[model samples]
Target chain A: MSTEIAIHIQDIHKEFLLSHSGSASLKTALLWWKRRQLEELKVLRGLTIEVKRGECVALVGRNGAGKSTLLSLLARVYKPTSGTITINGRIAPLLELGAGFHPDLTGQENALFNAMILGLSRKEATARIEPILAFAELEKYRDAPVRTYSSGMLARLGFSIAAHVDADILIVDEVLAVGDFAFERKCFAFIEEFKQKNGTILFVSHDREDVLQVSDRCIWLKDGQVEQEGDPLTVLDAYESGTA
Target chain B: MRSEFQELWRFRELLFAMVERELKIRYKNSVLGFVWSLLMPLATILVMWLVFKVFLRNDTPNFSAYVLAAYLPYQFIQLAVLDSAQSVLISLPVVKKVYFPREILPLASVISNFIHLLLSLPIFFIFLFVIYATYGFEVSPFTWRMLFLPVLLVITFMLTAGMAFIISALNVFYEDVKYAVSLLLYIFFFLTPVMYFSENVFYALKDKPYGMLLYNLYHANPMAMLVTAYKKTLVPMGKIDPGGGEGLIPMLPMNWPMFGVTVAITLAFFFGGYALFNRMKWRFVERP
Candidate 1:
């Protein structure tokens, strides 16, 4: 794989105004400035990173350490408030369990819609449905509504569709945290396969072994900034020891 | 902005799938299904016939047909805009999880409701046929100009979509948007030419200074113009009853210049709505 950069997130800062009550109505919004009930919650503060094409990087962090927020920004689910992110290829993100699944839609329908949204054409997504359902081991429930699926089933299907997308970069969060052992193994195998195909990956995890097994590099985020980064074993050791 | 359009074009297939999903979910497991969809307008026709023709003793000849021409379009406007107002809020979880053209959320709602509007059409035609046969009404009111139904619908679509974009995005920030929108529609129902004919408004403003301007202003409300245009195209502008019966309001001539202005403004609303949505989309995830 060429060493060209695939993802460039530079000097990114993201902040959310922690509203005690969400300003979901005009009446509240009109009084929002008057009440002064908002507190600034800065999730990612002046963070920067770059991922080369075909690299697999894992992020390990404590809860609220900004790892998920960083992954979301890369996925383009949330834009950085005070910085620019330049991505050079199509991105397929598996951010949560059944991220885009509609409860009323059949598994097959959700698969097609999810795959299409991830940059697959109708023909391409249709062709991949069998393999996707097969990978998720959901062939028996293909026509069943997604709402009927368990959380594990949802994760399996979400991963299967993201695996099939024709994307150059894949961003993942704790989506794999809920699936079974065999499903997790299958996901790791797919990540290895994706890496071999020159795909860039950025993933967030709480598992140390997952960081070591899949990531060539590991980044430890602390309070929205990169505290440490480099060889997975070294960073993992640092992260674990530092947390301990 | 150009990139946004290009991205939306690339996801056009997804848009249609979303529209299909919306339609499927509306009547998901109900046994009556499509019949349930037709029942609302049918009931509207019945109530109009009972109240206007029987109870009020109004002899405008084919009364339900007139009310329906206006009522049907208003339903389309209300259904599309109201559904769109909640579209983003309902899909917030998915919005925070994935990325597609955010505009698709509201666009799908508008389109599915447009299909609902299309599905509602046959009932109107069926009611018209029944009235013609039962009442021995004068020669059929439909003229060749009925071909312009699609053009009138297109204008109404632009107006609703524009309003949907603005409201759906605003709703994410202000929860009151949906309630306010329904309230606004209630007010507009009275303002537009839904219960009565456009000719009534024209005659009311006939001779006074700035009367033409006032008429133009009323038609500028796209809903008002759309319903009038629907009646003008569907029912002949000429008199339906030569007997000069009670409740017989004259039909107004099609105002070509005002129509041109309305079309331009409707296009502006559509684009303006889209622009506002795009501006607000990136911040949607912040509140959650």
Candidate 2:
């Protein structure tokens, strides 16, 4: 149906073992290693979901609602403890704001490293190098270390790299918030292009306006379970009305 | 194996990139740059030569050359282990980001140190020529012995890589391991026969079985064997060959058996290190 589901999620679950404090002592570490003393924080309960080809879906939830965790699972960054996720095409993930950047390395060098990490061949990475720099509009500062850039500058470079990655599915996590208003408009434009080209997107956002503006469909996640799902306007209205 | 090789092959460019980064970072903000790589070993060699040969006045043949050869490989070992051990923690920023093969960090350290060693070669040759010209020493025939150099490098690389992977991975859980490895590497420096000869152990042991145990441990050490092979490469025939005299032509071949041992031990270290790193990588994702 519709040339195979782009992403198939069947009853996924995840739980993390968190320490009592921010850091672990030798004693706590030993206990953690032995699994003799620990507290489990269950993040994602039994949840099933799917996204078809050419679909634009928004995952809306409050902080700690497992939106990031679900995206991480899809990206293969974190494995599901008990579920199967079979994704049919290449994945382009803007997992976090400029996660691959080195503080001391130039923005140009970080682009090269980030491209290679995204599964591009070295030559392919080199070919896309100019376009990425141009899109970020940091051609002048491309040779400067990323540490010199503001948060907005770093996000611009990151979003540019993600947009250039050719993939069937683009997993975005509040990437629009990284840049200023101008880049936010750019991200919405990219979303429109992506949808027109029949590319799949799994976007997570806390902004109802952004969700309603870009996503054709939306799912509201409360705690770890799906609270509601349907058209974006109806779902956003329900989520906002209920919370208010 | 093909898949593993494919994984490594894909990351080879990054490996070279990281090696370049390490070399650059090592000399960064320093006036001397990589001159430190040479000066440390050279200074130690001079000190040992002064203490053992000049002051003691009990000169073994080619004593200066013996100390230099011993110290050079030993210095390489010291650096390879220390750098490898710190590679992962040192690149925590990169490791926490988009994934490539993690082995690139340690392997990059190996390659960086190897480059440092390569830089030292011209100086080593210059030393060889100077000693020969001034001290009336003559080099042995450049036979198959020279082939052992590359082999020795591969072995040291493998051993360092393996140990580095294990230590760096462990350091993720325990911050103390950084200091612990520093102390252990210092101890290993003294234990390794870089400054002293293995023959000294044999002479010290004399007839006691305790000496035999020490001898076994000494030979079993991959680093010792590599250093010994390197010494044989640099030591002149006129000095060590019993068959040599005022007119007698000397002939001593390379130690093929020792070379084979080094190769096997190195492969063992590399495979073991790689396997351990693969097993531990997934856990490292959430670690730091």
User: Per model, how much of the real contact set is kept?
Assistant: 0.69, 0.13
lDDT of 1 by residue, B1-288 (tens): 789899999899989888988888787778898887678777877887897668866666566777887888898889899999999989988888778889999999999989988887877777777767786766775578989998898888989999999999999988887898999999998899876667767777867799988988888887887887887777656543212243355665787887888898899999998999999998888863
Please provide TM-scores computed only on chain A for all of the candidate models, following their numbering. 0.92, 0.93
List the global CA lDDT of all models. 0.84, 0.75
lDDT of 1: 0.84
Q: Which sections of candidate 2 miss by over 4 Å?
A: A1-4, A21-36, A95-97, A242-244, B27-32, B56-58, B90-97, B141-143, B237-265
Q: Mind giving the per-residue lDDT tens digits that candidate 2 earns over B148-189?
A: 578666666677777777776777667667678789778866
Best by DockQ: 1
Instruction: For candidate 1, give fnat to 2 decimals.
Output: 0.69
Native-interface RMSD of candidate 2: 3.0
lDDT of 1 by residue, A102-187 (tens): 89889999999888878788899999999999999999999999999999999889888988887899988866565888878888
